[model samples]
Target chain A: MGGSTDSGSQNRLGRRLLTERVSGYWLQGAGYFAIVLFALIVLALLYQSLPLLSEYSLVQMLTSSNWDPAQNQFGFLPAIVGTVYVTALTMIMGTPIAILAAIYIAEYAEGRTKTLVSSFIDVLAAIPSVIFGLVALIVVVPFVGDYLAPAVGSSATGLGIFTVSLVMAIVVTPFMISLSVESLEALPDELRESSLGVGATKWETIRIVLLRAAGPGIFSAVLLGFGRVFGATIVPAMLIGGQTHLPSSPFATGQTLPTLIVNDFGELMSLPLTQSALIFVGLMLIVVVWLFNFSAMILRQRLQQRWQF
Target chain B: MDRYTEQRLFGLLARGAAALVVAVMVLVISVTIYRGGRVFLMDPTIVITPPGSRYMLEGDGGFLHAVLGSIFIVGPATIISAVLAVSTAIYLQSDYSSERFSDTVNMFLNVLWGTPPIVYGVFVLTVIIAIGARTSMFFGIVAIAIFQYPIMTRYTDEALRSAPDSVKEATYGLGATRFETALMTARAALPGVIAGIVMGFARGIGDAATVLFTAGRSTNMPAGPFDGATTLPVLIFDQAMSFNAEVRSHAYAASFILIIAVLGLILVSKLLAGRYARYAPGGRHS
Candidate 1:
């Protein structure tokens, strides 16, 4: 009887252990569910967008500049060009200033000053994109309309690609500063000391040795900033003035892919083909932004590996 | 060139660039304050009244409904996201997962994080339509939650991974189940988890793109998750785009309030992270 009772208790314990292991498996499965959801989102977008291929040839849809939804002719060239132009302009305007600020914070500023500057960048990062749009609408637009546009021999409505790009530059500067600061800070102090010991000036050391070592990280930061600028909808949508045609100048109004979706999505739903075309825009955004993000991640991973070795 | 000249020139350029950034930030804040401050100077009633109130030519309207709507949408969404994110973090950091799997998960999360919020809005809009549901706070909450999920999960995973392995081993040696071990690990990483949740909440509240199409705009305060609601960001967007000068000024006022709330949240998260740093093993070196 004693042996039988002992065996019964052992069986119960075994069942309990088995139940516990099963619960653990369930938990891990739940974790993987996020990945499943992401894949589903991608698939849904692709499925919705595939119909556009039948309506318009891929080359015609992508290359043609005319986009008249009322006439059933849909083209994405204008928005595509606007997106590329605005993102490029933002990088050109923002990157150098951000790098300089980051260098000052990472290499030059001491205790209190460093903390203050870093906090400023953090605060900038935390500000809402809508707020940036609103402020730009009030301040930057009027300035461009009144002063800069006229100076450049363009009519000054102040709602144009250039105005949008300027706001975008400001919006993305904080991200660049923070990322570049991390890359700069991650460099070894030994390198700086050796450079100085070898009779190199501080500026020369930073320009040559420190920057070269941190190049991959800094490049990744710029790529991340590009991704951010590309994905941004609210700021550009609010400021870009919703023009569908190709811009004649930086001072001319334009639309980006995200802005196109945001501005016309409500009306586009009534037209099935136009809705599908909008889905294609969303798909394009996903593709471009994902590439930038993936490349940045890879570069950062490689940098980490280098440091580990 | 002489070393002194080169150093001086570089220093000058750096300072000038840094100052420019500072100037830009200052300019933005000052412009908003100057313009938004007008609402207070003219009629404080406009700033205090609930949405759907009568609009006078002199800017007599309030955004209380938008403020409340934002809270209603973000509060439950943040809670839902936090629960999912913490669960995912706990499971992924457990011994059942492999390094390769973790890396893959991280890569997926990075991609998700980089996705435009507008795309999320579009995706949710399609889902809502297919299900025959109207645009409402429920849809908005779901959309924002989706956007916050990867962010919260990534941060929480970092925190959980920082938990010392010895503590985990001790729990396992005591005959604790994997679930119990995860619970213990979560307790140790509570501060970081809280910080992550707060960060996600801030991002969700500040975001306009994700909710733009999912949540139909309503003038009245949100009745429930099913009711159409308008948020502060959406309100700002609508008002800023209006042709009327008074409405534009009102948008600036709304922007100021939103800015204050978001900045406060960021500050709190920073303080919380700092407070919990000592408990994290990685915190010691940093």
Candidate 2:
């Protein structure tokens, strides 16, 4: 009986509810806009890359090592090779050091030391990649040019694939250490204590038990590091010496995908074929990074499942 | 080797590697300070000059213009990203979106997070050029907003997801609408959201690639958002690459400023995140 007298209040409540519903949908649409933007990025890169197909076959572009903008020859072999070589060298140098440090922090360090080491690593992670480039340009290049290249019997400038790899190693190490530390810390206490109970040394426990159990997680971390190294632009742009030739040695100057794009993009904009070829390099970078990230995600999910079990 | 000997060797190696990491960090910071310290000790004028000065080999130059330019570009980019990221996070956490759709969106965001900033520069550059727009601060902001979006969204999403379910249920039990519930949840996670925004801003401000092509380099200060300007990172890159010693010294000075700003923001964001954790239900005690 009282409800009939409150019809105006009921209408107001209904209007309020309707407004909330509309706002909810609008927010959802805004959320979806991020995904839409991602799709647009991929699509735009693909569209820009399409013009290269008419001039050069995909195989030719990927296999041939020529990349002269003036001659209109746009082979991406050297850049691709250079990227792989630099990333591989970075992984080789960075992975072992990072994993070892992560193990020490997660398994060996005590309270105060643990906090100090972890915070230091976090600070290292937060340092911008460009600063690493600056340091490499000033310090690493001279050291390599004056010392390392001479010892290696190479007549090469310091700004080459080796310096780029060293810079990438520094940049990617913190990421690797952080991820590996998380994985190592996630191991059960019982697993470690039991190993110690068996009269196993601490190193034995870590090597025979912890590392085996945390292998996938560590691998995922390595993959993430690899992905990071592959996508790095500024360091390579500054240190790789801007040569678009097949990298013959660690000391030889070369160009990576990112460095090539950054170095030639301004000039390439005037040439359609070369510009499309550069865009194609961008697409290749996306694909390579996607593969690394997807694998890392899959491995991480597997590790989680194993932990749950 | 005996077990004890092997363990000793292994432990030494591991400890040595850990120490090596610390040494590397010290080396990087010390080198930066040593080189970047010259501008302060020898040429204080380089960093203190007014805007609109020429940063040339024979001119009295400073990084005021680029420093101001970085601030102008990053401030709006961070605000735009924070709004979009928070809204998106709220939507995903609410019942307005399905789990499947949310998962897909998150996957896309992850990929976007991994996509290189240069690719973003290329994409935004192409679009801007197609629209007949010149390289300016506006394009820089847009590109950086896109670059920071995934990072902020991920952080905000994690914050929203970690919101205590009991709190959400209580709000709904009081007859609150979904939007109201989401807003309340976001409010409760404000520290984490702010931390995310701060981190994203730090990242956006420090990045050189995203603005390399979009924000055309100019020595003069940016007059407005539509005007062209140079940022600290880009200026560092350009000046370092030049064949002049004076220009290279200026680049070091700019790098010093950029590093200080970035590292400071990162420290602040970390502190904010720690504060957020303390407020979170079941979080570890400080």
Candidate 3:
């Protein structure tokens, strides 16, 4: 058997060597192609955006709050303010609900309830933002205007920072909940069981046991949700009436960075600097999200090192 | 407190809180229904119904052009992105070495992955429009494809890495070339690749920012890749913002379609991911 296998192995080795050479060549080629393609996209975008430096001073663009295109003066300061406010409000409103929902799903819910809830969250994750905005415009706006707006000291129109933020919160909640759920589920069952053995209630076990174990992961999810809300355009565009200035209050009118870019990019066609200024805002958003992702990666690595089943 | 009483309190609180989440789903459906369910049920004028005597379509309630534009943008982007991603993944998962190179590549991919679609849109549009890439559906397609490719590549790379080396060894022993082994032995991994692509496509289709700048608003039917087009998401944005009641109703109808389409893509991808995981080695959970 050993003698026969030697001959067979020799023939197989020959073919394997040939395949190895071909695969190695092709694989590297493919990887390089992807890299080049990605580089091209970045280069293209940067090339177009770089032209803005010739016309506008960075300070005037960033510091000036006025965005009146008719006067040819463009400032993104108010848009930035509105963007941060709405995103901050979304995080504040959505984070707790998401954490609680995640706790319920990971620790307490069982049987069909778990399946149903998980699938529901999955479906929610899939819904388009345009749809979210449309529904919010017709239904949420009217309801808020009729019921909550008066109480919140706003007019009966559905347009306001609070409305946009609320919709954004809803849009991002599923992402937070899903990530938190998965991280919580990844924790050791023994941890929960041991905590329970110590006579802790389920709620206490969740607070002390699950939260501690999944804290980093939950935080990462919230950061991701922040990015999602920050980049979202349609939700603020339609729901908040796409005001280019900062809202007077949380319940007042507002616009976000992406919405403003979308709303005004067309009008600033002749002013390449204004458009590039918008691109710079987008770049800042990318930078913020990149930082979040970097930290999320670091947190994930730490969690992997610290946790085990 | 007794065990039974304690269990009851926790369960009650859990159920009560969970009910609120259920309320959100209900709110989504009910609000959609309240706004446009009547039109769908009563008039049943989906956008694609044949045209009438005039140039006006018979059941022109939905933004059919936008829907078509979405499909148009998503379809090619999905194909190209999937191919790029899977190919890159295969390359990364190969016996290639050097830990530093791997880490560098991962850092680039992750940062690119985290970059939002809107930012990509703004950046890409500025680049393309400045270079005089005509404002058309093609630019939207390309912009979305560029944005989606990195994500697909990462997920596909992970899936390929998870593919059992033993299987590849077995294929190699059978005298299969690397490409053959990748194509044949790694064929089992295609489902996850498809899932990643579909997930990306779902995101691309729903995206509003990238297209808003690149794909200018055009109410007319798209002539070709270069033809200016308004996607469903953009049209929904337009109609939602419009003062016209008829257009607003049309926007609701379009939103209903987009919602259903996105949900369908997600569900199908989930199903595919499950099926892929079953036969796959180590079972990719992503």
Per-residue alpha-carbon lDDT of model 2 for A142-220, expressed as tens digits? 9999999999798766989999999889888988998899889988899999999989999899998898788888987
List of chain A TM-scores, every candidate: 0.89, 0.91, 0.85
Candidate whose TM-score is highest: 2
Between candidates 2 and 3, name the one with more favorable lDDT. 2
Better candidate by DockQ, 1 or 3: 1
Better of 1 and 2 by TM-score: 2
lDDT of 1 by residue, A152-228 (tens): 78995999899989999999898899889988998989999999999998899899888778877788778878888
Model 1 per-residue lDDT tens digits across residues B1-286: 7888999999889888888998999888777777777665676676568755543233445777788889888888998888888878887874768888877887788788788898998888878766889999999899999999988998899878877887698889998877777887876786778778887888899899989888887777678879899888988888887767877778877887787788789878878777876665455422
The residue ranges of model 1 lying beyond 4 angstroms of the native Cα positions read A1-26, A296-309, B40-48, B53-61, B173-175, B274-286
Model 1's CAPRI class is medium
Output the lDDT of residue A263, model 2: 86
Candidate 3: regions farther than 4 A off: A1-26, A29-57, A295-309, B1-14, B33-37, B41-46, B49-62, B161-165, B173-175, B270-286
- Candidate 1 residue B99 C-alpha distance from true site, Å: 0.8
Please give the distance, in angstroms, between residue A47's alpha carbon in candidate 3 and its true position after superposition.
4.3
State interface RMSD in Å for all models: 2.2, 1.8, 3.3
| Local accuracy of candidate 3 as per-residue lDDT tens digits, B1-286 | 9766876776676666667877977888667756666555655555774222222223234455776788888788888777777777776654563666566667777667667778777766766665777688888887788778887888677666666677788877986666777875456676667677887888788878778877766776778998888787887777777666666676666676777678788888888877776666566565
